[model samples]
Structure formats: structure tokens, C-alpha cells
Target: MNTQDPLSIGIVGLGNIGRYHAEQLTSLMGSFDIELSGGMDIAPTARDRFESSFGVPTYEDHEKLYETVDSVIITTPNRYHEEYAVSALESDINVLIEKPIAHTIESADRVATAAAASDGVCMIGFHNRFASPVQVLKQYQQQARFGDVHHIEAKYIRRRGVPGRGTWFTEEAASGGGALIDIGAHAIDLALYILDFPQVTEVSGVTRSIFGGRPDYTHLEMWGRSGEGPFNVDDSASAFIRCADGSTISLDVAWAANRPPNNEFVVQGNDAGARLDLSDGDLTIFESSSAGAPHFSDSEVRTRDDDPHRIEQQRFIQASRASEAPTVNTVEQALTVQRVMDATYRSNERGRAVKIDSEPLPTVD
Candidate 1:
């Protein structure tokens, strides 16, 4: 990228997510030297809306958009990720793909393989890691403030927030899994990230399709599927993950559950603990202080409220300009998250814990 010229950026899958990134990237044009080259989607209606809304040209195929942009954000459905991402990488175009890397382990493996062989960079969209609180907590962990961090209880629950019954989100073939892949993927990735992306040994999980199949399912809000569609996937999932460093993670994720939603993560360590509200950036640390006799202490960490999506977008463009594969959110790290998701589904089927082999992971050194 020339300093005199802006870094050309593009977006794929002009659905809700695609428009979201376009809006963010557009808002950032004045701050950073970047352009929203164009948008691409298979749907004509979506393309029309994107062009009118953003005033950028739209495409029905990724090939044309790929010819124009240096880097692209693939925010399409999980199944279509591999198609656009691999094509872009082969052309040496950087990609920032959305979470759950691909629809299945095999597809994710192919994407990762392409990233490895290509001269382009690919970063997974686990955008939650860019949140202010998460960054602060990670810094504390690096400082050894949370000594011997052992376990993380990650929860991303919704009392009744299903995307309705007949959408790509509820379709297993398109989405991989329901709540596990949709929201639980974030919980799993964030927990693994906080623990410095530990090596996993085993995973035991149970997936349930409680409310999604019900004809009279009650929900306060639905994100997609206006009327009714095919709902053949799990709506909730629970998993217990075992790590090689004697650390464990208890995961609870649901799109629709009977209990009230609790979107908080509890990080337990030998010396201290923390409770973070996933909705907001409120974080409180729990520790026992030795001053003035042993006693418990609580410290609230207040951080700036910046949009994680915008932050991630800026980082991707900057990193892509620096190296073919910038190490912020590596494809390997996302693959590990995919392995856990894959293992969770397997465990659900076999009714037993599944074992995973540890592998060396790439980092942002």
C-alpha cells in the first residue's frame, strides 16, 4: 500500500454483517487512508440495498470485487466462507473472515491450508477479543496479576433470542450448529484467548434444540427469518473443556433457555478472580489482599467504550499491509476454536468426551 494512496478494502456477503462492516469502514475513511472499494452479494435485493445505502458499487460475484480491492472482509454465511476466502487468498488478497471459520472442520482445514500456501493474509473474526475490557484483562494477565489462571466460566446466554426457524443460521448445513456456532463460538474463542490459547486435551459437550423446533416458541426478538424456515440444529450447548496446562473451562451458551440470560465471564485464578459483563465493558477483579491483615478486595476497571468491529477493521488493514499473514487472530487459532466446536458436536453425538491432539500454534510475535 502506497502512503500517498489509500488501502483499498472490499466487503463480501452484503447481508446485515456485510453492511455493518461497510458502514464502519466508511466511517473510518477520513481517519485512515482506506477505501470501501465495493460490496458483493449473491442476492440482488441485498446488492441494491448496499449500493444505495453506502453509495458503493455492488457485485453478484466475488471475482469482480476481488479484482478491485487489496483486502476483503468475508462476512458471508459460514458455509460460503471457504469459497470466497480461498479464492481471495489464492489471488494474494488478504481476508478477514467471520467466526466459526467455516461450516465444518474439513472446510476450515481447507481454508487454513489455503492461507498457509497463499501469499495473502487471513484473520478470523473473533471480534470480542478487541473489546476494551478483554484487552485490559489480557494486559493484567500478562503482568501476572491474575496468578496461575486456571479456569474460565464463559457464558453467552439469551433467554429467548433465536433467529427464528427457517434461516441459514438455524440450518446445520449452512451454519454448522445453532447456538454453539453462532454465539457459543464467541464464548469458546474468548475463553481460549484469555487463557493464552491453551492446548486442549478433551471436550465433553451436550447440544439441545429446545425452543427452536417448537411451533409456538416465544421470543422477544428474532434477528432473522421473518416468517418460518427450516430449523434443524441445536439451539443450546454446554461443554467442559480440559486443557494441557491443568486449566479447565466450563461453557454455557444458549439462544433460547428457560433461565434468564447471564452474559458474564468468570476468570478464576489462584490469586484472584474477575467477573466481566459481556454486554458492557464493566470488569471487576476479586482478590485477597495481604495488607492490614488478609482480606478480600474488589477493583473495578473502567475502560474506553470503543467499537470492537471498527477497531478490528483498522487492525486488519494495518496488519495486512505489514505482512501476508498478520498474527493478531491467526487462522491456526481459529482452527483450534473450530476443533473445539467440532469436538463439541461429536461429543454430543457419542455421549462421551472426545480427545484432541495438541499442536503448535502461531502467535503475533
Candidate 2:
């Protein structure tokens, strides 16, 4: 493979996100020497729209796109993540699959196995890790700024924000689960990333579908194609996780809730604590000084204009060129997060804390 040659990138699943990926990739071509090979989407309307807008070829079959591109971005729903990702890897093509990896632990495991055996690069699109505040938090952890971390509280709640009431998001079979698997994947991955991907020992959780079946429920924004389908997934979820190192994490997420909208992660440590507001990308560090009288200090940390999705794509291309899997977005780390999510649902069903037996997979240096 010629490292200097421009990489050919293709996208699968031409939905809103897939189009956004195309836009970003198109914009990046000016800076990074790359080619927009083409795209694939099952929806005929979507394929037509994408081709007409981007002036790029669109394929009905993803295998045809895979045959042309050096790397592919898998942006299909959670259910199709594993199938497409595994196929791409098996074909010796690099892949960047969206979050959660797969809809089930079994599927995630198969994808992980394929990634471990493949020479091609595989990365999970946990783009939040590239956010400026999140990048700072990870740096703080590395610098030991948060001394001996004990607990992390993560919440990604939206008031009246149900995505496509009748779409695959509301269907358990298509989406895997509800709020936990959707937005909660972002929350859980961010928390675990900040904590350096701790091994979860146990998980206790509860899930509810209070708003999905409500036809009278009103919302400001509803995403996806709305119609009438199975609303058999949870709209809200809460969970408590215990890690092997004795640290813990409290997670709360919902697509629609009665409370005020909240998207933040608070890390509590012995020496200091920090809060990150995901909405505006602001980070606040809290510390107490014991001089004379105990005084508290709250300092807001400034962040750069970091576009995480763009950064994530650039890094993926770089990693593929180097023939190395990214440490932050590897299949191993995503498998750990997926296992935690699976345990949360199981714990909810069992009405007890579910013990986690899956260990964290290894990452390449």
C-alpha cells in the first residue's frame, strides 16, 4: 500500500448522519489529500438525494462501494453495525462504525473477533472523545489532576426529544434498546473514557418507556421518519455501575423526560473534581483550599474550537494510513462499553445487580 496515495473513503447509510459525513469528508478534501470514492444507502430516496447533492456515485449495494473504497464509514442503525463492519473487515478494508458497535453483545463480540484478526483498521465512532472538553478531561486524568477518582456521574437527558416515534429507534429489534443504547452510549463511553476505560464488575439498572407509547406527547423536535411502528423500547434509563478498582459510575439518560435538559459529566476525585457541560463544551474544575479556613474555588476552563466529528474522521484516516488501530476508538474499548450497556438492560430485567464477566479487550500501542 502506498502511504502517500490519497485514501479512498466511502460511506454506507445515507441518512442525515451519512450526509453529514459526506459533507465533512468533502470539506476535508481541501486540506487532507483524499478522495470521496462514493456512498451506499438502502433507501432509494436517500441515495438519489446524496448523489444529486454531492455529485458522487451512489450504490444500492454496499459491497460494491466496499470494493472501491480503501476505507468505509458504517453509519447504519445499531442493528446493521455488526454485519457491515464485519464484512468490511473481512474484505481487508478499514471501517469506522458509529457508536455502541452493535445492537447485541453477541454481535459486538463477533465484530471484535473480526477486528482482532483483520489487518485493516477498525474504529468505533465515539466522536465525543474528540470534543474539546472531553479531551481536556482525559488530559486531566492523565496528569493525575483528578487524584484517585472514586465516582463519576453522567447524564444525557432531553426534555421532549423523542427521535422518530415510529422509526427503528422506537423498535427494540431495530435499535437494540432505547435511550440507554442511543444517547446513553455517548454518556457511558465518555465516562469510561475519562476514567481510562475501567473494568465494570457489576451493573444495576431500571428502564422505562413512559413517552414512546403516548400519542398525545408533544415535542419540539422529532427526528427520523415518523409513522406507526413498535414503540417497544425504553425512553429512559438509569444505572449504577461498580468497577473492579472500587470506583463507581452513575448513569442517567432519556429521550424524553419531565426534568430539565441536562448533558454533563461530573467526576469526583480525592484531590479535585471537574464538571463538563456537553451542551456548550464548558469545563469547570472545583477545588478546596485548606489555608486558614477551607475555601472553595470554581474555575472555568476554556476550550478550543474543536469539531469532534471532523477530528475523529481525520484521525481515522491517519490511523488507516499508518496501518494501526486507534487507541481511543478501537473495537476493544467499544466492546467494553457495549458490555456495560448490555449488563444495564439485563440488570433491569433481573431486578438485581448483574455481575459482568467480560473483561476489557486489549488495545494496540
List, residue by residue over 206-308, the lDDT tens digit for candidate 1.
Answer: 9999888888988767786554568899999999999999999999999988997888999999988899997978899999987989899999999999999
Query: For model 2, how does the per-residue alpha-carbon lDDT over 1-365 read when each residue is reduced to its tens digit?
Result: 56778999999999988999989999899988788889998889999999998998999988999888889998998899988998998988899998889999999998988888788999999999999888888898889987989999999999988888888888889889989999999999888888888788899999999987897988877877686887899999999999999889999999999899999999999999999999998999998998999899998999887789999999998898888888767788888889889999999899999999965464433
lDDT score of residue 329 within candidate 1: 80
CA RMSD of each candidate after superposition: 1.7, 1.4
Clashes of each: 2, 0
Clashing pairs in 1: 166-229, 166-230
Local accuracy by lDDT, each model = 0.89, 0.89
Which ten-residue region of model 2 has the weakest summed lDDT? 356-365
The lDDT of model 1 is 0.89
Residue 118 C-alpha lDDT in model 2? 83
- Candidate 2, 250: how far from true, in Å? 0.4
Off by over 4 Å in 1: 1-3, 359-365
